[model samples]
Target: MVDLASLPPQLRRAVDDEMRRLRAGDGVLYGDMTSEEAHDLESADGRALPPDGALDRFIAHATVPPADVAASDLAGYTLVGVVPEGPGLDGPWSSVKRVYRRPDGVLVMLHEWAYVAEGGGVLGVRELMNASVRHGTARCPAQFAIRRAPTGQTVSELRWFTDAKVFTLSVAQDVLADGGKDHGKAWMLRLAEAIE
Candidate 1:
């Protein structure tokens, strides 16, 4: 077994933090068992282990599912929410959105803004217009795709980029697929009203 103590300080710290988080019920730890091992275990007693028992053991090992799985598989535990506008690199007020794998799963966040003209000049207008033409349509300017550990289903969210300001939105898989679509469309319409 790899000696945790022999790892670099940063790696050790990260491992420690991850262990703590997992123990706190914020996440699950699963072991990396090969297909052969799984088959052997399943065939050992001529009967399969209960589903919950298998899940519990897998969680204990801290196993991460393969990356190829789509996020849609873990929809039951996925969540989404909007982050409030806040200060930014240039100044105050920016919008951001966050997606959670499980209620406590790692959060994936996205930020976006409209392309604005810098000055009342033809060049500036042309540049801004070009950007708007490419990214400012009914389609969401910002989006997120997530695949939860252990189960590789994919969940996604799409949102309007709107103005150069910030806003946050959060939701779960069903909401993201259904309600979020409407919400994003509405946001796009509102943005068009403001700009056009």
Candidate 2:
């Protein structure tokens, strides 16, 4: 398991700061929804949310999985989030609500979120996969990947690949960086063990 205690001071601080920022104010940010609410939404809407909403839901949502649900249980499902958009190392892109999921559900989060310059898109599949390996939530397996556009520009495309299922995440400018920072890898590792 990854060690939060072992995290570099800067990375630890960055994650804490981001979490604090996300939790600030009236509305919760990531993982903020109650199971009932999520269940209801899923039943009514038929899919996960975009990053913006997902973050809030993630924050608010119960960290403990339902009695019957396990990390492996999500293998074939798609999760989506609406991420807030923001400036990138380069330029900017339209604020997007992205989707992530694995049709086979073998993968937990087919497309985890990452940040780039304002206009940066996916650069290379390998780079994205590496990012996921480095930055993805501990409880979830790396499912999504980012790549720079072929134009050789900073613009990127955050893409999801699964056995089949598709989920979505909505994002905003503020939270884009939060997704990338290596929060306490230790904490993440613990969370992963708990969930798995």
Candidate 3:
């Protein structure tokens, strides 16, 4: 009953593959029950396999999921990609993220990093302030930079650093019929302030 169709293409495909394998092998919880319901059974009957998900602290190392944010906050964007790295052998030790794009083709990439972790911290705020200056970043509450992207499109980036996490909003310049960095910056700032 999982709505696999609603997931992003990559995630859908991956989950579809896993569901098939599980169904074929009868290895996963399969029934009408919700995951929480199934998990209670899973936990009580546990054989010490492995956790199916990353710890919340580990997930906190990445950008907030698009689903967690209000739809209007996205300014009409839809999530198109996800990079999930969880607590596992080959997956990353921290951080997962999503990519989103709007109808007019504005692309936004949000990335997060934890300042503290169990072993050590992930390094760098994208070398902010240092590199922000090169891109002419200005600070109000945080640094805002309009820099040229590789494709020559401009990016309006808003970044903030805190005791526990670093959050960034990078929006491809030009949005709405009004257009240009001004609109994009307004959009980015609105999204940034709205997030918390």
Question: Scored by Cα lDDT, where does model 3 land?
Answer: 0.45
Q: What is the lDDT of residue 17 in candidate 3?
A: 64
The residue-by-residue lDDT of candidate 1 on 106-125, one tens digit each, is 33223333223221111111
List lDDT for all candidates, in order: 0.31, 0.31, 0.45
lDDT of 3 by residue, 1-196 (tens): 1255566798677766645432221111111334553342223213222223433433454433322345336635656554444455344434444456667656666655543432444323221232221111433235555444234444455666544445666665533225535455456556765553
TM-score of each: 0.22, 0.21, 0.47
Best by TM-score: 3
Superposed by TM-score, candidate 1 places the C-alpha of residue 175 at a distance from the truth, in angstroms, of 6.1
Tens digits of lDDT, candidate 2, 114-142: 23222234322221122122223322223
Query: How far off is residue 42 in model 2, in Å?
Result: 22
Model 2 local distance difference test score:
0.31
Pick the lDDT winner: 3
